[model samples]
Target: MFKPLIKKIAIRIKFLRSLSVNHWRYLFRNLNLKELNIILVSLGLAATAGLFLSVYDYWALRTPAPAEGGSYAEGLVGEPRYLNPVLASANEVDRDLTTLIFSGLVKHDESGRIIPDLAERYEIKGNGKTYEFTLRSGLSWPDKTPFTPDDVIFTINLIKDPKFQSPLRNSWQGVKVEKIDNRRLAMKLPVEYEPFLENAAVGILPQHLWANIQPQNFLLTQLNLKPVGLGQYQLAKITKNASGSVRSMEFSPNPRYHEKANIARLTLRFYDNQESVLGAYKRREIDGFSLSSPLEKEELARSRSVKFYDIKLPRYFAVFFNQTASESLKETEVRRALAHAVDRASIIEEILKGEGEIQNGPFSFNLLDIGDPETIYEFNVEKARNILEKDDWKIGDDGLRQKKIKGKNIKLEFVLTTTDWPELTRVAASVQKNWEDIGVKVNLDIVPVNAVQTQTIRPRQYEALLFGEVLGLNPDPFSFWHSTQRKDPGLNLALYNNKKADGLLESARQESNLPTRIKEYGQFQEILMKEIPAVFLYSPNYTYAVSKKVKGVAVTAINTPSQRFENINKWHIATKRVKK
Candidate 1:
């Protein structure tokens, strides 16, 4: 039967060939047999290749390129100084880097509650002062080494060193971190700490690798820029300049990462300002960086192809008045007068341009657990002049506020300092003019943030300063206001001292109940309103723009906001072709 079928097919092919020879002459009278054969062979080869490629592609779809899902753009004002979490000098850039390259014992939930990360679970011992954390089984770093509590101990010891110059020195001042076993750890603090886990901002380092290297000396080492950690991304490649600065880095996902990350490769491309960075984003040069200035937000809003994410962060921007002065700002009336002089309302609308609401005080305005809207001090310049007159701060011959103190007519003229943060610069100009309107003269001295913190703020050399504080996950105000913080090394920028205010701060930290805590905080603000050490300003809104190609972005409080990226495994890029 098969032989007959083959003979039948041969007879039909011979008949078709004879017809095709005659037909080719009819269509192309001058064509040769060789030309006709070439056309048929070419057509047959093309059809066979098309069918083969389609089948090959069908199989190719079964195995996709490693979890690569999206693209994004990040803007920065300058290059990051350090990548080590313990030695990270610049935060705005380091926070993004840390979230990708490092892991901590615990992470902050969207609601600011502490949740386990590298640590499986923790128990409260010593009545809330001591916290014993146990590492999760199978926990491993990007390099596949098992994680243990000694890593935490190594981190704490490095910060506690007097000369290492860790930025977190104040937070871990009297705390003791010790490894109990291979998996268990204990943190002992001098007093009850309500936000004990908030210290998780200190990303755990590998004890075996970093312990022997002195942090004070390691900052200049080659390993500082190329450090390893237990986060989703590992430093695959780094390019440096002649001066030894990391110019760019390409990060690859860790194969042993606890969970798979959506991104296959994350490349950090740095630039000098938001303008250059935005240009890179428009050209698709970078994926996933921050928008540093207000102008960057405006540009992102105009670009229809890009997506902008604005999460209200715990970072608060405002001006502080120095009260330790024996001259112009000595009286409480003078401080109240200065507070009411500025127009933070207009500044927020014109300068901030997004979701930041006016702070009722130094707490979250939309927090379900705390923050009262009624406590915000209203802007009133009319009330400002009244306070000045009561303090004998009459308009002087030179038109600045002046008064007789200790037999000298001390004119209210002081220097204000700030980083080149654009928003702060504009507000400083506005505040300067506002004080001038009320007959108080001010001189503006804007400089690098490093200079301000180290030279100006630390020495109390400047009379006042215009800057912002990155609020921590916990709501306690003790670190900023307590007399203990008034030391030059502490966050006591304002140098405010009120025993009653200190007591209120401690009370807020101890009380876990919401109602009594709210009432106490409310009363505390009511008292601070009268005390007026620093003029609280409006909390402005900021947006972090991403390329529309990426997804899974939500709001986060500024302190640990990028903790949102812990769920990076869930995000995916659209499979559609990217639009220009």
Candidate 2:
């Protein structure tokens, strides 16, 4: 029956073709010359219309769409020692790989908002002290083990364990995790902490695989070199050089991954230094690389094929005044005068090469309105001098200002301590020159990096400390500002203490609602501006260089170098043409 139907259709097609040919022949043979010419022109016009329609139809069918199945080679300036999430916080190379290999209960988006990852949804309860998280249904690790409350409780408990020595120990201290059921968990904090959600973004570890490992041997475990994760990518291959250093690592998409990653494979190549990294990129040995050091104008000009992206980190550099250490720095007028004397704009432009944003206060993510642009101090030597003079500070014959307090002559001189990095030294020198121009003597005491942290900052020995604080996303200024943190090991380098500011900081930390947090933070900034304890300098941009071959990279905020890969699942190396 089907054969007869096919034969009938073929016969109809042949008959139609024959009729069309005979009609065309009859018209050509019998028509007059003028009529034939008219028919020829009409046929030509119809053919031209048909040609245009064909081209338009072809073009319409081909529209660009994201295509899969490509690999990427990224270069970094360090080797990975620990791929485990519990220990890779300070290692950029390790963090880069771990970010793609592990999934946290919560993860930061490109905009730095903390969103749920392994958890289906979460809620804050009971005065913001208790956090309830519900895990997504049917979640599994790369090895097909069911992801449950046990994994979440195990990770938190391990972090809180003193024997584990995990880098996340500090954040989880005083926080207790309770397993409600297979898919539910609750975390209770000693106090209301707003950054708790951000802390939850720490990658979760597989309980079954790690439970057998002892705490002392956790770092030495081979799993650090070959990790099992529940992220978009899983460890596939690792190659090492003769020197016993990891040369490269290749990652493939996880078969049990919840979502699809456009990138099929990602390979990372480790190098010794920035020069070697840049050389590899120039030679096309690698596709892209990320650097904390911003590129110089000449260096940026050299990379013609690479696309550069600038992401402003949440860190800022400032000269924190120790009021308790120096008698002169204790005066509010003197601190304000010194703050106004330094040219922050010039420091960023000349020393930072326009790669930093001038910071008005502690908040870097625009959590507060900068408050009255007129209040922002500008570089004015005369204004600074007049401020000192109005406060009865007299200029001495030595070109230094002096003030008489309690029957003692104290010169307007203080030692400024900072690290020995060339960039920081240049900034310190620039700031010193500006302060000295205003009759304020500045003694530059540059020390080694470790000495600056251990000797000067930790002990609070310097009169003024020049330092940078990396405030992670969902920044909580409590550790850096609250009066309780003014002692040794506390980040309140300025020794700042104010009842109103303290209350603001404490309340801000407890507020879980974003708008309320922003409001409270704005009030805290206002207090900082009024107090003028620390002179805020500039915020540096995290620069990344990538090959133009990759696309769909949208990095707006980066809390760490690893956060740059937050959108790796959306990045594609190839494309296809499909209908719009």
Candidate 1: which pairs clash? 72-287, 72-288, 73-288, 74-289, 313-558, 314-558, 356-541, 401-439
Top model by lDDT, which number? 2
RMSD (Å) per prediction: 8.2, 6.6
lDDT of each: 0.70, 0.82
lDDT of 1 by residue, 170-285 (tens): 77888988888989988998887666577865677787777677645777865567777877778788777898776777777766566677766667777766667777877877
What's the true lDDT of residue 456 in model 2?
Answer: 87
How far is 534's C-alpha from truth in model 2 (Å)? 1.1
* Candidate 2: residue 69 Cα off by (Å): 2.7
Error of 2 at 213 (Å): 2.5
Locate the minimum summed-lDDT window of 10 residues in model 1: 571-580
Give the per-residue Cα lDDT of candidate 2 at 403.
94
lDDT by residue for model 2 (97-168), tens = 889998888887777777788888999997889999999898887667899889888888898898988767
Count of backbone collisions within predicted model 1: 8
TM-score of each: 0.82, 0.83
lDDT score for candidate 2 against the true structure: 0.82
